[model samples]
Target: MRRVSVDIGGTFTDCFLAFDGSYVEAKALTTHNNLASGFMDALGNACEQVGKDVETVLSSVDAVRYATTLGTNALIEGTGPKVAILTTAGYESTVPLMRARGYGDGLSEAEQANLPAANRPTPLVPVTRIVGIRERVDYKGEAVLGIDETDVREQIRRLVDEGAQAFVVSLINSVVNPAHEKEVERIILDEFPTHLLGSIPIILGHRVAGRKGEYARTMSAVIDALLHDQMYHGMSSLEMALRKAGYKQPMLLVHNTSGMAQMNSTTSLQTIHSGPVAGLEATNYLSKAFDQPNLIATDMGGTSFDIGLVTADGVKFYDFNPILHRWLVSTPMTYLHTLGAGGGSIARFDRMWNAVEVGPGSAGSDPGPACYGRGGTRPTTTDANLVLGYLDEENYAGGTIKLSRRRAERAIQEHICKPSGMDLIDAAKAIKRKVDHNMAQAIFKEVAVKGYNPKNFVLLSYGGGGPLHACGYSDEIGISRILIPPFSCVFSALGAGNMNQLHIHETSLYMMLYDANLRQVLSDFTEFNRTVVELEAKGREDLRRQGVPDDAIRARVEVDMRYGNQLAQTGIVVPFRRMETAADVITLLDLFSANYATRFGEGSQAPEAGVRINVIRVVSYVEHEQLRLRPSEVRVGTKPVARAQRECHFPKVDGAVSTAVYDASAVAEGMTIDGPALVESPRTTFLVDPGWRLTMGAMGSAWLEKITK
Candidate 1:
């Protein structure tokens, strides 16, 4: 297969090209002003490596996939259009109130604990723009009061006159019944038809999120409406750029749900954190390819450090109500936690500890790090790495940019060293150690919370900064083995190439499998079976709309079930699509019990309280031919010649050590390099600390195994 995939991140844009039997990787600084410019620059770099022009390569490629942080950046930067909400009468405070817990959404545990410091995110739509209409729908899907057509028209016009750029109709209980919401949409369109200059896009709550929770569902629709124009224009510009380069195929977008779809089939909410999710998908592929079913994937890039888990048990983890930026929204997103720790993470002196503290703040791409000499005066992890002699000053990013050692020293001296009583080397060492500890703690918490042992999984480290600090963080987590995958710099892009086209459809309803209240079991299966089929049909139609054939499509069934009146619902993927017999219901309860016990603890199952299914979901996907990857083989004790030597400092070590440096492009497959050593590539560098050894493998793949505790 001849294909190209690209991942646009905060600091850089990475591209992966797979053709015939060759794979190429390329990188370029991200152009925030115009994402397409950075995208084409990275692709052009890959084309140059293969001796082809952009037009020639793009015209003949099978498919072009994109996994980007565009939507995420827009949300963080508040670059979306002003959105107005229309809801059931008397719920004017729904968006503003956002529930009591909404104030703590997207905040750290410490910040959440400090009540006086907690505050809700700035309102996406002000209360004045959130006029309510006379409409009501009960949880039973019964419309008790029809929406007044005149009321709907007047409210939409009032919002428009108040400078509303888009409209969101999110009446109460819309998930169970959308009649009131649909009527409001019809009224808005009639007042301002598509052909008129006052026309606006209308986003229905039920269509954006097919679940319950009035607050979460409404926020989902509001966020979708806010991001609609930004995503559409950004995506359109990218597509136009591709067309100018002679590409005729429709561009596919990677979604955070571990699926891919054409632009027409995607929603703005699905694109948040897509780049990181694509990296996790690559980890899933690596788990099978490397014959290691359990792995911890870590991507430490310029802006953030992301951690994701993939285990041997075929269980996929998803967050049904994940917080996007600061807004809590209801969407089924594949779970991946991000920490504001990376190369550009700024380091400051914390007076409380009399030591250094690394970031939840970053320098991003523009003005990058102090070492970049791009007007960045703040001391960052990148500056520390450069000061410690891990990065070559003249050869950084293949000489596309030069590093300034003097500037790095000046930043550290003025900020970290001056605040504390420490010298430059000690300050740099402290920054490295602190950042590594922060990442290790986050990984441990993510794994332990899931009831998995960090020691049981091998760490798969990628991104530009991952290999450089793999030994430091892996040792802290008690992990002895680290696999830096082939094309590590563009691993997420490679994963995007292997994704299947998929769509998910679901509905909220109350169904009892075992009623502890009545001491009875479910005797009727007709309603349960019908809901599953209806959800399946919706998913099938979605895939068919994207031109997928019936034979190529398949479906999976999942349901969110809980015990008693507990707010936590455990999602279970059922092996059987339709439950016919009483035994099938028992099987579902058993599945939920087992999964719950695994997540919480053994004997934590509360079937004695009651058993109920809150939501039913169907996943329809069309499997495409995946790009084949060969397993990497390692040879031990075959040492490669060194290119040079440099003096590097390390934490917990006495002083500067003479480190042997090797050019990554010149190393032979299966050659080994023992620490303390440095492996330098044009795009990234690998640091092998003392007590660790590096084993070279095929296709730029390598292993960093710790030799000592």
Candidate 2:
């Protein structure tokens, strides 16, 4: 039961150690040098908390699970190897053209709506590196034209000559039939040969993504090939480090799929944002643990706010065509949205609304905020928080990063107030209100768009900035209950510790379950069962390769069903592994209809057009025992303890008021702190606005309830 989980974030590296029953959590400033150094440092901190040494903990632990943002940082920094793409001849322009809507793939609605100013992100594979081959395949995998082997060899040679360190082979409808892609790889290997140092790494698009969108599928392959080397070497070094430390078990890496896998079974793309995905996994676990069915998990950090949902119905949401870096990819990543709003988000005057605008632009750790004395002139959300008296200047980030009230005021006044012709206090208030409203709107849209009510869900706030502003945004959306979970700073790391070993495999097919034009339904289960079997076999082999016992593994079959030729695919976890009768087809349709109705609204079902299963997915896993945390019971008659007092301004109040400040460590369990108070922890600050109160719970967890007058 000894295990260690770590989450490498942009600002900090969080570690959670589960030593038998006792859990210890610690954090350290992330050093970008060799990430392992920071990881070791964070783990050392956690071990120290348990009165143990790093070697003792590492050697004794059965497993160490890591959920890192390294892939995300690499994408943002464009630090991967140069890649070359070879696709079907006619589709060479697809990646650059970007589906016409790809420009908005990872942007906010407002940013998307402003089309004229929109610019596509730089291509992961430049046009010069993209070459096409003469090959054609129909949607059904029927070869329309033979794959010209000579043409494939020529394209490979040209790309290699043009300095293509890696190759991505993405042919049309390759998921239906990968003959052409396989042939291209064969030729590449034949020409370069594995024995030679000139052998180029090749990634097949169909193998990477089992879905239809050629552009997205190709991009997935491109990114995978691009980042493959870096991820492999980095993980290998980490594994070696663990091995050297005397750990025998494989280093389990957390995947974004709410699962974990040994290094050998994971792809570079599967690990992107695994940290936040692990946070969602924690939410899922928490929901079952506390019997809280509906929950919205929010992680608000320095530069971004992430939202993930867990419903009472056990319905899972997935994005089949998720954008990684700048490339849209047909990969079923866990459904999560990142809003460009956080503590370091820049706050500026919005002339259009004559209000304020919080950013998609961020003052990252480099210049940070003006209060950090990092030469940042523009005022940010953090500055606004400081000016509003929400954060204690002397105790920010465990007082490691000291804040200057004068700097915050000057930055807000000169950049926001002077420009907007408002006073500093008013400007700060406006910034706070605007940022809260923006976050509220985002949460509202994210949930409402999926056919759920934000009011019905309990908000779980984590991350450094989450609790500080949870009440502000959640209150606007009628979310009265907010729970700051135990070990909030290391929540994601805790999540990584509770995951099962899993592998997902899927394949794209053009199978129409209900052919509206023919007025007939598919009666034969052979094709469907065959595809499911193949995918399951692939997943099983992955786990088997990782040394999982055959009897211990389980599989879940899901089909991405859609009505007609619509873009939206509603994934349905099939009740039975095989569809034996026409009645089973009807059952799937009924389920899809109900789920689709719930999401897109009733009467939105367009079954008259047709019914089809675009992709069949199989999730194979071996369940493991989880480290459970006990929730504290609600206690009455709790009172607040004030450690200090300060004059602070709140937007809800008219003028400056004397606010009580409490050291988070000194706050006893069951104690309640009334509004207009600041709770300072080493990791984060909790600002109890006027009309709200904070109740301290066990394990450093707290609850903030708004007082409705």
Best by TM-score: 1
Clash pairs detected, candidate 2? none
* lDDT to native, each model: 0.90, 0.85
lDDT: which candidate is best? 1
Off-target runs (Cα >4 Å) in candidate 1 are 634-636
RMSD of each: 1.3, 2.5
Q: For residues 1-709, could you state the per-residue lDDT of candidate 2 as single tens digits?
A: 7999998877678889999678888777666656787788888778888888778888888789998777777877788778998888878899888888788777656787896787888778889999989998888789999989888888888888889888888888888889988998899999988899757788888888887788888888887887788787777877787777677788998988889998878888888889889999999998987778999999987778889999999987787777775668878789899877888899888777787888878886657778888788888889998887778777787676799989888889887887689998899998888888888988999999777889888999998788888888988899888889888878989999999999888887668999998899998889999998898899889999999889999999998888787878788999988889999999998999998888788899998999998778999999988988777776664676688898888777789999998888888778888888888888888878788888888788888888765
Count the clashes in each prediction. 0, 0
- Per-model TM values vs. the true structure: 0.98, 0.93
For model 2, the local distance difference test gives 0.85
* TM-score, model 1 to reference: 0.98
Give lDDT: candidate 2, residue 200: 79
Residue-level error in angstroms, candidate 1, position 646: 0.7
